[model samples]
Target: MSRSYRTVHIRDFHDDDLDGIVVLWEAVHNAVIRPVYSLAEVIASCQEDHAVVAVDGDQVVGAAVGRAAHAQGWVVFFGVSAADADGQIAADLLDALERRMAPLGLAKLSVLVAEHDGRVAALAGNGFGMRHTLRYLERPMPVQRRELDVLGDVGGRILPRHLWEAVAGMSAEKRLLEERLVTPLAHPELAERFGVMPPRAVMLFGPPGTGKTTFAKAVASRLGWPFVELFPSRLGDTAGGMAAALRATFERIGSLEHAVVFIDEVEEIASRRRGDPPSPTQGVTNELLKLVADFRDGSGRLLICATNFVRALDAAFLRHGRFDYVIPIGLPDAAARAAIWGRYVPASVDIDLADLVDRSDGLTPADIEYAARRASQEALARALRTDGGDAEPLGLADYVDALAATRATVSDESARDFLADIEAYGRL
Candidate 1:
């Protein structure tokens, strides 16, 4: 049995669980979800937002992932093994997260479930409000960066050269870029408009290290724009400098008129326009207020901003039209974790992490990839040193050690606390 009856623990995902997570993700979503997305697209979903899993005995039976933009949230992927002992597991998981979060003081939390999916009942039972239809749009990233400047001939503007090369180098993420950013914002004209505009800003919010930075580069490369990166530490020297610096950022992007500007970990800048520390300020808040106001009505090239702390971001900044569509750069769900696992691990290894991956609850792609890389190194080290360089290929135990080496050491209590929110809210 995949589930163990004695325990169910929820926590952030660890690096080693990539493979099993992917399998469960594909299995549940593919079976129950309507409006099926491309396998690439579907896998990309794993990389967005945050999620939680359920376990009973040794088997994993349920999961729930929620992504937020503005006041709305997409319960993008969720399902329980209907055939598993608890067909109601999806609902139970989500219920747990909401109960945990409600006391923490949030005005609203939203989720989108498959309309026809019985899982909607899980949300309904939890007091979720119904909303409009939503669809995800995407396009391919250019294969090479465009060398020509913005002034180049119109036909020569296919994909700018530098941007293409950056994207091309990231094989898997490149595929995601093509699907999520490049395709939707394919044209320079569109990028410029999106970049310059304020209210309808383009936002990339996801779990940490999901290549939001690379995705930003892909946008810049695809659009042939000059890219500017902003650091949080620098933004808030003085509250007064914020508006001016932001204007400068806008002006710089506009100067290129075809450029793309990126601000990584922007939540810091907003929360720290005054940069005193973690303390929030009226001055900093006001500065952000003005910038967001101006940006919605902005004109010129594209602007891309990314933040790992989506929920921590100010609500005023998230209002519709302030940012056009807030895209999620979530953790690598199961399939993406699988792809990451396969891409990084050699097939010659005899161990399969399917069991571990299934067990892992909330690891990001980067986390999983790092574990794989470390595991491979461990195997090679054993082969070269302990086994006189004739050590057999990596085995399950080698993979297990690799996993143990990288796995997060979460006390059982802490794991429960971190996962308390998701278990209450999402039905994954």
Candidate 2:
């Protein structure tokens, strides 16, 4: 039933849909998420929202996200891409949610939506009345990191160390799972159940810095697969032109046997074409869909797509048989965070590694590394002040101050929330 319904039925929300969700959010909302509403906020909404996506074979044509609230409180965060922002998707999300919330006595359902938009009208058409408008806040300040250029190549397509690092710490049972990453050979049981399934699209969706890209890189590196990363801009100048580009992408990917073809922030290439004008990259989605089916067609390349916003995606890309696995990278846990922190802290520094890791809540590995370096620099500066200062080692104060100074840059609160979100949504 689930597989048959993939043609029109709504599927669940996933991290691979992140890029799509973000695009629609940025496009229609005329807004940006940060400071006030971090990526964790989105994950938290998803926590309660029984997000459903509408799929047709290998193409995701529509999507909706909604959940029940107390006293039939409300359902929010529902929208479909490039179309009237309506409850078409909402109704579907709400139907599933109502059942989930029914035991809790979910009564009248509601949604927070744009007043004039068709979606709002559609929700209203579906029995939701206008509610008081709440301002979606935005921060006037610059993004804290000041280093927004995450696009810079981070060690070109090498096997990332962390996945293997994670395996090193896991038990033997987990090692078997990690083995899947190293060897493209799917486990016989899993292969029978999912590997040989009709479509073989792999979706990687999550907030930035959950190591989505790094994990894929690590997997490719571990498997000794040649990796290729593509972007929306690669789709060519015009619609027909884009189709050709899309064809070329897979054609190139197809040639790599037992190789990994990674599409980072893939939703840009995979969004559905609704009533809205098509972006240059529109055709790429359809093309990729066909390419994914080729997995069953016998081209042995691993297809991986990653995005930060999954809600905006077309559902076809998420159909079970298409991608053997759909994974969302959650934020690092306390142990992972502590380990990241420990790596950045030099053995030369005389500080409690445990205390440092405990305090680093929502930090990504990169963030932890940045903070550790600053702390070390500060410690070195302080040591220079004493007569024998050069002989003195860096202390906890340096690490603490280093962390404190960047506190607002990447708030501790944000870190915790992000961590929690990942733990809840992370597939691994």
| Candidate No. with top lDDT | 2
Query: What digit string (tens of lDDT, one per residue) describes model 2 on residues 1-428?
Result: 12233235566766676665555445445433222333444555665555555554544445554555567645545555553243455555445555544666766666554435556655666666665756555433211232222212211243443454552221332343355444434343565565543223467766666667777776665555455676656555646676676675566445444456677877776775564586655566777777678655664457778877665576777665677656656566676776677667777666777787777665666667778899888766767777564454777877777777664333556555545644543343
lDDT of each: 0.55, 0.57
Encode model 1's per-residue lDDT on 89-152: one tens digit a residue. 6555666555434554556776544656566665676577666667545454432234244223
| TM-score for each candidate, following the candidate numbering | 0.47, 0.52
Candidate 1: 10-residue stretch with minimal lDDT: 150-159
Model 2 residue runs over 4 Å out of place are: 1-163, 166-199, 234-242, 383-392, 407-428
* Error in Å for residue 404 of model 1: 2.6
Question: Best by TM-score, which number?
Answer: 2
